[model samples]
Target: MSSYLLILLLYVFDQAFGESQLKLVTVLYRHGDRSPVRAYPTDPYQESAWPQGFGQLTQEGMRQHFELGQFLRKRYTGFLSEPYTRYEIAVRSTDFDRTLMSAESNLAGLYPPNGTQVFYPGLNWQPIPIHTVPQDEERLLSFPLSNCPNYIRLMNETEKTAIFLNMTKTYGDFLEMVRNKTGLESTSIESIWSIHDTLFCEEKHGMTPPDWVTPEVMSTLQLLKNFGFQIMFGVYKREEKSRLQGGLLLDQIIRNFSAAASVNPSGPLKMIMYSAHDTTIVALQEALHVFNGVQPPYASCHIFELHQDNESFSVEMFYRNDSSVAEPYPLTLPGCAQRCPLQDFIRLTRSVIPTDWDKECTVNTHSSDTDVIIGLAVCGCVLLLLVMLLFIVLCRQSEPSIGYSHVINQSDDHS
Candidate 1:
C-alpha cells in the first residue's frame, strides 16, 4: 500500500514540475507538380500540348498542397488556432505563378475562413499575403546560384573528381545517342537532367515516352539526374558548397528559432512557411547533412519544430517527401540526436552557415581575376569612347564648326 502511494505521488510530482511546449514551426516545401518547363526539339509534344502551356501548376498540384495543409492542420491541432491570425504566421514564396498558387492553396486548407475570419458567406477562402521578390534579386532559396563565379569553379573542380569522371566515361556513348536522337547540339552529364525532366513530367501526366525510352533507359537517366542533384551540393567538398548555396536558408531558420526561443511564451510568431522548388529542398537538406541523396519529389516538405522544455530549448526536424508514409521521417543533424539541444544544433551547423557569403564566394584564381580585369578594361574602353564623343560635341558647340559658321554649300565645299 505504501509503495503504491509513493508511485502515485512521484507521478503527480513529475507531471506538475515541468511542461514541454511547442514554441515554433518552420516549413519549407517544394511547389507541387508542374507541367514540363519545355520539350526537346524532337519530342512528340510541344508547348501546345500542356494545359495553359509550360511550367504552370496543375489541378493535381493544388490538391497536393491542399492536402499537405490539411495534414499540418491535423498535426498541430491544438497549437494552431482554428482561424488564421496574421500575427501568428508569415509566408514567403519564390516569385513564380506555381509557387504563389501553391502557397495560396496550402493556406486555403490550413486556415479556412471561420466565424470572425469569414468575410463572405459563399466562399471559404480568405486573402493571405504571401511576400516575394523578383527572381533576379533573390539570394535566399535559389539553388546553384549562377551569379557566383566561385561556385562555378567549384563545379569545375567537382567534375574532376573520380566519381564524376567515372560517370562521364560510363555514360559517354549513351549521351551521344541521346544527343543524336533528341536533336540537342550535345548531351553531357550536366544537361542530361533536362531530358530526364521532360520525360519524367510526360510520364507523370499519362503521356507515354518515345519508343527509345525503355524502362532501363529511364532508370539510367534517373541515376544520372540524381547524380546531377548531388553535384550541386554534395559530390565534393559538400559542406563548403552548402555554405554558399543552402546555408543561407539554414541561417534564416536558426535566426527564427533563436527569435522564438528568446521571447518564449510571449512572442506572437508561431509559424513560418516557405514555398519553393525541389532544388530549394535539396540545398537545405544538404546543408543540414541529412539528405538521403534522392531527388525531393513534388510537394516534398522539410519541417523544423522548436520546443521549449522547462528552461531549455530544443529543435526537431522532419522530412516528408513520401506521401505514402503516414508521418514525416525524423531527421537528425549529423552530430546530434533527433531532438537536438538548440546550442548543440547551432554549433554542429556552424561550419555550413556562412559568416560572409560574398567573401567566402570570392575566388582568387588568376583566370577569374583576369576575367574581372577584362570586364573592367571593357568598361574603361566604353567610358573613354563616351568621353571622346562628349568632348567632340562640346568643342563643336563652343567654337562653331567651319561649316556651321560659313554655311557652305555642298558644291562650294567640294570645289
Candidate 2:
C-alpha cells in the first residue's frame, strides 16, 4: 500500500509541476552602434564628420556584435546541427544601412558559412539573406512620434498625472538651469535625445565635442533618454499601445519554430537573430515584460533559450549587455510558473501580443446598405411614437365643445 501511495503522489506532483522540458529558441536584439544618420544645428557630428561617413557602423560597434555572434555560436555549438542549415536559423534587420551592415557583420561571426556552401573554395564567408521592411511600413518596429488627435489627448492627460507633473517640471527646470549655466541655447530635452547621436558621430570620426558637455551632463542626459523610453513604452496613449509595443510578429516566429520542433523532434531553429534599432529592442522587451527603461547598448541582445524534459517544454530568458562579457544576465518572465510550461508561456505572451494595426478590428465592411436600412427602420419606429404623442395633445386642446355638449345633455335630463 505504501508503494502504491508513493507512486500516486509522484504522479500528482508531475501533474502539478509540469513536464519541465522542451527545446525551442527565439532571440530579439537591437543592431550595433553607428554614426548619426542626420545632424541638427549646433551639433558636433555632422556629415563628413566621421571616417566612414554618416550612417555607417563604427569599428567598435562592429567588434561588439561580432563578439556577440561568436558568443551565440559557442553557446549553441552542440545543440545546433553542423554546417548551419538554412532552416536552422533566421536573421532579420530593419532597412537602414547601419542595421543591414550590422546584420551582415553579426552573421559573419555567427554562422560564417563553411564546407560545401563555401563556393570560393578557400574562404568560408558567404552572403546570408537579412529580411527588412520599408521604413513607412515599419510602424511595428519603430516607435513613431504619433501625431494623431487621440494620442495628443493622452499626452496632455499624462502631463496632468502626478508622476509626470513632478518629473516634467523638474526636468524642465533642469534644462533652464543648464542653459543659464552653459550659456547655450540647447535645452536638456533636445540634448538628451540627440546626445548619443552626437557623441557617436564625434567619436567615430576625428571630431571633438565642445567643453560645455561635461561627463556628468552626458550621464544625466542618458538617464533622461531612458525616461523617454519608459514613457514611450508604458506611458503612451492607449489606442497606440498595440502599434508601439506589439510583439506578435516575434511570437509568431517562435510559434513556427516550436511547431516544427514538435513534428521533427530533433532539429529546429536553434537561434534567431534580429538586428534592429534601439527602439525595436525596447518595444519588444517591454511587451515581453523585460524592459530596462534604457536604449540597449550597441549589440545588446535579449536571448530566449528553450529546454525539454520528456514531453513538456520550458523557456529561459537571458540578457547580454556587454559582448566582451562571457555570461548572460539571467532574467525571469513575470507571472510564469517555475520552469514555465511551453503552452503556458504561449498564453502569457498572448496577453501582450499586439493586434494587427493595419486591419481595423472594429470595421464591419460586409454590413453596409442592409445594415443602414435596418438602422433606419429602428429610427422610423421612434419617429412614429413621437408623432402620435403630438397628435393626442392637439386633439385634447381642440375638444372643449365636446365637454359643453355633455353638460347640456345632463341639464336637459334634469328638466
Candidate 3:
C-alpha cells in the first residue's frame, strides 16, 4: 500500500512541476550592418564605391543573420521541427532589399535542407518564403509612419522644446563644422548624422578615416546622432507617440499571443519573425517601456516568449544585443512579475495600444479643420465650374439659332 502511495505522490509531483510548456514565440530583429545610404558631398567613397551601391547589405551582414539563425535553431531545438516546415513558422520583413535579404540569410541558418529536400546537390539552402507588404502600406514594421498627422504635429512640437533648443545651441558649432567639412548645403541635426554614419561604416570596413574626422569629433557626432534618434521617437509625448508608432506592432504581437492561447486556436504558426530596421525595434521597445535609450546595434533581436502552466498563461521578453553573449538578457515589464500573466500584460499595455490607428493618427483638431476647409474649397470650386458650364449652355440656347437664321434668309431671297 505504501509503495502505491509513493508512486501516486511521485506522479502528482511530476505533473505539477512539469506542466509548464512553451506555446508561442515572436521575434523582431534589426537588419545587420550595411553600406551607408548616402555619402557626404566631399566623401571620397560615393555610391559607386560600394560593391552593390548604397543601402544594400554587406557580406558581414549575411553572416551576422546566419549566425542569429543558428542561435535560434539551437534555442528552440525540440520546439521547432528539425527540417524546415512552412506551417510551423512565418517570416515577414520590410520591402527594402537589406531587410528582405537578411530574412533570407536568417532562414538559411535556421532551416538547413534535410532528408530528401535537397534541390541542388550539396547545397544546404532551400527557398523559404519571406513575406512583405508594399513599403507605403507597411504599418506593423515601419517606424515614424507618414500617415499619422498627430505624430508629425508631435514631432514639430518636440522640436520647439527647451531640450531640443538647448541641444541645437550646444551643437551649433559642430553642425557648422560638419557642413563646411562635408561640402553639404544644409546641416540640420537629421542631415549631419548621415555624415557620421558614412564615417562609421567606412571605419568598420577598414578604410582610412579622413583627416578632419578626429576621435573627439567622431564621439561628439555619435552623441548627436543618438540624440537625434531619441528626439525622433522618445523625447516628447513618448507614450502618445508610441500609440501611433510602435504600439501598432505591440498590439499585433499581443493579439498573436492571445490568439495562440485561445480555446479554439487557429493554424499551426508557432513562430513569427520580423526582419526590420533599428527604429522598428526601438519603437516597440519604447512602447513596452524597455528602451535603453541607445541606438540598437546591428542584428539586435528582441524576443517575446509565451508560456502556459495549468490553466494560466504568461509572457516573457528577452533581448539579444551581442552575438558573443551566452544568453539573452531578460526584460521585466514594470509593475509585473518577470513572467507576467497574459491578462496583466494586455492590461498594462492597453493604453499604448491604439483601438483605431487611423482615427488616432488624425487626432489633431487643427489638421482636421484644415482638411475640412480644403475639402469645402474644392467642392466650391467644382460647383462654380458646373454652374458656369450650365450658364454657357443657357446663353447659347437663348441666342437666335444661327443655322435657322441662315435658312430663313435663303428662303426669303428665293421667294
Which is the leading candidate under lDDT?
Answer: 3
Error of 2 at 408 (Å): 52
> For candidate 1, which ten residues in a row score worst on lDDT?
399-408
Local error of candidate 1 at 299, Å?
A: 0.3
Instruction: Give the per-residue lDDT of model 2 (tens digit) for 359-390.
Output: 43323435666799899999999999999999
Per-residue CA lDDT of candidate 3, range 164-240, in tens? 99989999998999899999997877666788889999999988888999999999999998888787778789889
Clashes of 1: 0
Candidate 3: regions farther than 4 A off: 1-11, 366-415
Which pairs in model 1 have colliding backbones?
none
TM-score list, all predictions:
0.86, 0.73, 0.86
Note the Cα lDDT for every prediction shown: 0.90, 0.67, 0.91
Report the Cα lDDT for candidate 2: 0.67
Candidate 3's error at 90, in angstroms? Answer: 0.5
Q: Is candidate 1 or candidate 3 better by lDDT?
A: 3
lDDT of 3: 0.91
Off by over 4 Å in 2: 1-22, 121-124, 144-156, 176-191, 200-206, 235-244, 261-268, 355-415
Instruction: Write candidate 1's Cα lDDT for 197-299 as tens digits.
Output: 8999899999978899999988999999899998899979999899999999999999989888884444688899999999999999999988888889889
